[model samples]
Target: MIVLVVTACPAGLRGDLTKWLLEVTPGVFVGTPSARIRDLLWDRTVALCNDGRALLVYSSNSEQGMEFRTHRHSWVPTDFDGITLMMRKHPPSEAKRRKGWSKARRQRAAYEAR
Candidate 1:
């Protein structure tokens, strides 16, 4: 995933970062800007920003899409930084896992147990 920083002061430049992502990283997820860090862009899953203002703009996964959640300024920064660093250090997607059991398997298991 890629992390992006955006400045509200710059309008046209905002799309520049998006365009870059399109060219270099087509499957990137973009996060909203905050009071300090600005923005974060990640690929695949949603990127969490501690900056309470963080908004998710791009996400391949619909579930983790942007949804505003209130957060305190004191804790947000640390949480955001920690989560960002963790994501960068060890990035993983939940969708890549095996499908596990199907309906038929569940039914069979239930019947066997009975």
Candidate 2:
């Protein structure tokens, strides 16, 4: 069994997926297809995602008995203690380091030099 979910994707992509999977709801598809076809569909989805977010979940032999792939999503799949987990992308720090000394430091340096 496999499930696919897409957000903000092209209208044609939804139509294309309907050929192989059932559209259980808007942006959600469920189906059971051969491994080859599943891969092909995922590839097509990635190609057509176009800045949209997509997630593909399929049955696997892993510990969880399932595996998932994602495209253009902030949350990433991670491996922790032999288990697959979803982790959010960390944002960059906003505070930047200053290159030069402060006014007080400069004034102290000048006094010490004298």
- Per residue, candidate 2 scores C-alpha lDDT tens digits across 60-89 of 988899998999888898999989998988
What number of backbone clashes does candidate 1 have, counting pairs of residues 3 or more apart or in separate chains? 7
Clashing pairs in 2: none
Best by lDDT: 2
lDDT of each: 0.36, 0.94
Models, CA RMSD each: 14.1, 8.1
lDDT of 2 at 54: 96
Model 1: per-residue lDDT, tens digit, 44-67? 112233222222332233344322
- Those runs of model 2 whose alpha carbons end farther than 4 Å from true positions after fitting are 94-114
TM-scores of the candidates are: 0.21, 0.80
Highest-TM-score candidate: 2
* Regions of candidate 1 where Cα sits further than 4 Å from its true position: 3-7, 22-76, 79-114
